[model samples]
Target: LLWETMILPIIRGNKLDGYVLGTKLCPPEFLPRTTPGSTVKIPNPEYEEWLSNDQLLLGWLYSTMSSDIASQLMQKATSKELWDGAKELSGAQTRSRIVYYKAELQKTKKGGMKMEEYLTTMKAIADNLAMAGNPIPLPDLIVQILSGLDAEYTPIVTLLTDKISVSWIELQTNLLTYESRLEQLHTYQTDGIQANHASAHFATSSTTNRPFTSTNGRGQNRYYNGRGARGRSRGRGGRSSVSSSSSFCSRRIVSASCHLFYKSTTLFHNLGMCPQIMKCRYNWSYIKF
Candidate 1:
């Protein structure tokens, strides 16, 4: 904005030709003596007009400056001196800004922030640092980001570090992809658990409602508990007339289609086999005794 309004106008008007060419086009001229014994130094009309124009331009520059900054350029006798002073001050500020950005980058951490938020902040700081004249190396930047991630990102960090070389854009893409996959994995697990619970509940209710058959000497029919993979029995139906025995089926071996039945009072699970209800020849009963 300043260049368009102030600097461009001065340049177009050839007002800054003397400064650019390093030659004084409007030289000072001495005035003729008015008295024999009086000594005076009065500038010629053209020199006085040039001095006034330079002063006006310098005042415009100072008008936009802070008090402290203006003070530094106030003593400059020419436009070149003032321009050089302003450039030097700008260079110093740029260096200071670079230092500040470097410090901020070092202090950055993932902490409780999301992966994307942290990465964006790191990227913004890195960009500013580069603009300010302290560009961070890609490898070092990758290491810094990996080191600051939370425990949840440990797997991705390990994957990245195990590789010999990685580019910044590739690293960014991988991190975002990893985060998206993690969210999908988490959602899948939660949904799987809910589905399992619903399936188990439906299986239990259906099994309980179906008829059952008992294989004991007394020939009593009864229903079995469907809450788990355990077995229930009454009296053994062998010729020796042995008392009934109960056992639990291993959950690892059970399938979603597993349903309870009895074979000679020896609960079908005792066969150490997953029972197929549709293939068994036992009679069905609904009594819950």
Candidate 2:
């Protein structure tokens, strides 16, 4: 933007600034002073006018330039010389700078970054290339951008590649729209998973919180109190109970698995498995039942 606003227009042409197509408009040799041998010769009006305009343009360039750049061109006698020197300095680095920008554009990935961030990264590199006087053509830049995106963006990339010509504005709009669509899909999938988990949790909790009673042949009754994965179950026939993920209803039993205990009138049953109940096992990687 700065180049377009200030540098570009001035580099084209300006007769008042003694510049035509970025070259100084030199005065003719006859225009210089030819005073007597007094050693105090004043410049002719035409030559003085040219000198004044050159100084004006030179000062303008210096005012717009950074201190380091202006310092480098301190030996320049005219605006065109200063600008040419600046161009020479810029040219010396252009090849390396262009290589770096092209490599970045080709290798950059959209992984884990937001859409805006990815676009900004690509655009900033392209702009720097333009500032170095080696602007990447739009079609090539688009190809590079498409190449750098993750596989998730392939559908939109394919659509763009099929077109004959795609403007930059159109490309950004499509990319951002596709990104929003991806976000929507991810949100929907997350909601579905959470819903399934909630249903499973509800079923597990409700079925495990009831007391189940069974009768023996001799009029003896056994009561089984159920608990969830992290609860305790108790047997009514005996005073002893063991605790685990489920419950152990034995007089003397100790284990880490889900268990159930029941005692008939005759004797207590050691670590017995729960009837028609899930026995859950847990570890860092996964859960099993």
Candidate 3:
């Protein structure tokens, strides 16, 4: 369990030095070299057993070291292959790799693997190799050999491509659906507002009275008591009685005449009649009072 969880990533990440050191301590050839001698035969069996156990440990170590180196080479080769596919895509691919590396590094917070780091470093090396136009590295050549051993590679690629195509179609469909819904909602709201305004206009038109009347030959109508001259005299007499102690009596007759003329002219004007009276000209006489 510990080997699977802890040590596998180190092997996968291409940190070969640690694996090599561990494997060199124990080699499988050491077992077969032990012989059954006349005097040494007694201890020979134990020695041979020890060699067998060591060989098992060494085998795991060697395999891990080999895989780590291979993963690095594979990453570099894959980058080159992608670049060779399209020259225009090189920068975009490099940027995407960098982003992927950064995100992977961040995920290493809880004692994660070194493979991600090694792969990132290898990608950088690959980018440099591409820029220099140099020959492919030996380890990368070995990776190409190893990749051919996996029969599922083509199937995995096809599966991933199909998934990406489906995702793109789904995304486009969702966007179009959202845009159509938004347009419909906007149209509905606009129509509702216009309909409400029209309804309000109709209601107001129905309730409000017309201030002007062409049927009566009047531009505007005015309310007045028909007994205007008599009404004015009675109003003045009532006012005089109420303020009898004041000097308003000195201008009483002039005030009464001004009031009667103003009412008469205003009434005639509202009736669409051009009154012959020049009462407005007499306004200065009332101003002096």
Best by lDDT: 1
Writing each residue's lDDT as its tens digit, candidate 1 over 1-289 gives 2222346465548656465234655566667656787878776888787777676766766676779878876788766667668777867887888889888888899887777898899988888777666789888888988988878889989999999999888888889898887777666545544544554555454445343455656655455445544355666563332222221212321233233222222322332232333323142231121
User: Which RMSD values do the candidates have, in order?
Assistant: 11.5, 12.7, 26.6
Cα deviation at 103, candidate 1, in Å, is 3.3
Taking the tens digit of each residue's C-alpha lDDT, what string does model 2 give over 1-289? 3333467565456544335235456775353354576444455677677777778877887888889767877988877787778777766667788899878887897788898899889989999888766788989988888887889888999999999999999999999999998887666545544543454445455445445443333343334455333333343343323233344222212121122122110122221222212232222122221
**Candidate 1 local lDDT, residue 215:** 62
Q: Candidate 3 regions off by >4 Å? A: 1-166, 210-289
How many pairs of residues collide in each model? 1, 1, 2
Q: Please tell me which model should have the higher lDDT, number 2 or number 3.
A: 2
- Whichever of 1 and 2 has more lDDT, that candidate is 1
What's the TM for model 3? 0.20
* Tens-digit per-residue lDDT, 8-114, candidate 3: 47544754433323442322322334456633213355546545544444455435434543343333222223222323333455566556644443332212323
Q: At residue 280, what lDDT does model 2 achieve?
A: 25
**Candidate 1's TM-score:** 0.50
lDDT of each: 0.63, 0.62, 0.37
How many clashing residue pairs, candidate 3? 2
Order of models, best lDDT first: 1, 2, 3
Clash pairs of candidate 3? Answer: 13-115, 14-68
Taking all chains together, each candidate's TM-score versus the true structure is: 0.50, 0.64, 0.20
Which parts of model 1 have CA positions greater than 4 angstroms off? 1-53, 56-99, 111-115, 151-166, 200-254, 257-289
